[model samples]
Target: MTKLQPYEKRPYRPGVGMLLVNDGDLVFVGRRIDQRAEAWQMPQGGIDEGEDARTAAMRELEEEIGTAKAEIVAESRDWIYYDLPPDIADKVWKGQYRGQKQKWFLLRFRGQDSDIRLDTKHQEFDAWRWVPLDQVPALIVPFKQVLYRKVVQEFAPLLARA
Candidate 1:
């Protein structure tokens, strides 16, 4: 029998993440510039105090990816958590957060390709592209792979219908 892994005792930052899809069911991902090395991830950001998860999801989608031209189609039933790899954990959130406890959302893009912009007032990604949902897990950092896989599994049906 496998032993259940215990949840880390560290605090997780409250954040919202987006799984934005186009008609072909491809998901939006971006190459993060703030990382010390190469990394690709979906749009995500911190949720402000008192903001509901859905509102934070929309706000994060636009703030990080440069567009709010999407509608929330589904939300994760529970908060999903990911811990930062030890090397950078103390540096990322000023030692206050170990990683993020995210509310993931599946958002359907309702605007043209031209409507997507990366050069927002506060840029998060250096480049962006649409990728098959299954490939997302492999593209992100190792620590977040499990979370990404769960996200793909959670939204696979909705992804197919788009």
Candidate 2:
């Protein structure tokens, strides 16, 4: 049997992001608990070992936002990445990660707005909302601006259909 290798530090952490859009074309977003001012972002989290990206995305959506009433509509073929600025990199994830490499998905939200609950076992956000997809990049933290921009561009077509 091949021996397991020691974990090596990488510049990007493996993760997934969810773009849950409703029938009205509004996208789900939340204000991060760790930030004040303007740090709203879509639900996202790390992918677990042995988990596929699509499953991970749905799991993360439920884990972060307390709902799983969504269906995958589109997925980005490439892994999108975001580099943490020094100020944030210095404090987040014990400084072990430089940033995140994410597989983003466009999911159609099937539940009513009242179904969302942020008081999860491990709460990541203070509040949540369904906003216009184009407004996402601006609401997200600056580090993820590029990732959100590309995500919107790629998934915007799905929204147009709704």
Candidate 3:
């Protein structure tokens, strides 16, 4: 069995979020800036020294996707975590939290697709689209695919009920 990486016991590690939805037939997803780099990830970032998780989630959503005031209809009771790739982990953390322990929030899009922004203000996602949620597992980076599977499985019932 693969042992999970030990997390640093801290107040907060800066992080971001991915807000997904069930629009009858599709799920909203975004692509990162460079396909060549592993930068293509769900909106996420580090938490400010005094930032709360929920507030930070909202701030990041706006900064990264130009989304503001989204209703967090659902969220995971637990925080899903992943280890940093050895190449960048040491430099990324720089004596902070060893890894991110993310609280995944599933939000319902309250506005139109045009609201998403990929510009100088927040260039987290260069592009966005709605795709079959089932296919997300295949599109994301391999390391994150495992956590994505679990998130989808846990939230499957919610989508079905919608």
What tens-digit string does per-residue lDDT give for candidate 1 at 1-162?
A: 433223355588999889999988899999998888789999998999999999998888888877799999999988999988755775566656678999999999998888888898889899999999999999998899999998999999887665
List model 2 lDDT by residue over 36-128, tens digit each: 676899988898888999999988888888889999988888999888876576567766677899999889999988888899999999988
Model 3 stretches astray by more than 4 angstroms: 1-16, 34-39, 95-97
* Number of colliding residue pairs in each model: 0, 0, 8
Candidate number achieving the greatest TM-score relative to the actual structure: 1
Worst 10 residues of 3 by lDDT: 2-11
Task: Assess candidate 3 and give its TM-score to the true structure.
Answer: 0.79
Q: What digit string (tens of lDDT, one per residue) describes model 3 on residues 1-162? A: 433344434333546565567456366677877567643455666678888877877787788777764677677778888765554454555634455678777776677777767684747577777777787778788767787787777776777554
Error of 2 at 49 (Å): 1.4
Which segments of model 1 are wrong by more than 4 Å?
Answer: 1-9
Candidate 2: where are CA atoms >4 Å away? 1-9
Q: What is residue 104's positional error in candidate 3, in angstroms?
A: 0.5
Q: Candidate 1 — worst ten consecutive residues by lDDT sum?
A: 1-10
The numbered model that scores best in lDDT is 1
Residue 26 of candidate 3: its Cα lDDT? 60
Full ranking by lDDT? 1, 2, 3
Q: Rate the local accuracy (lDDT) of all candidates.
A: 0.87, 0.85, 0.67
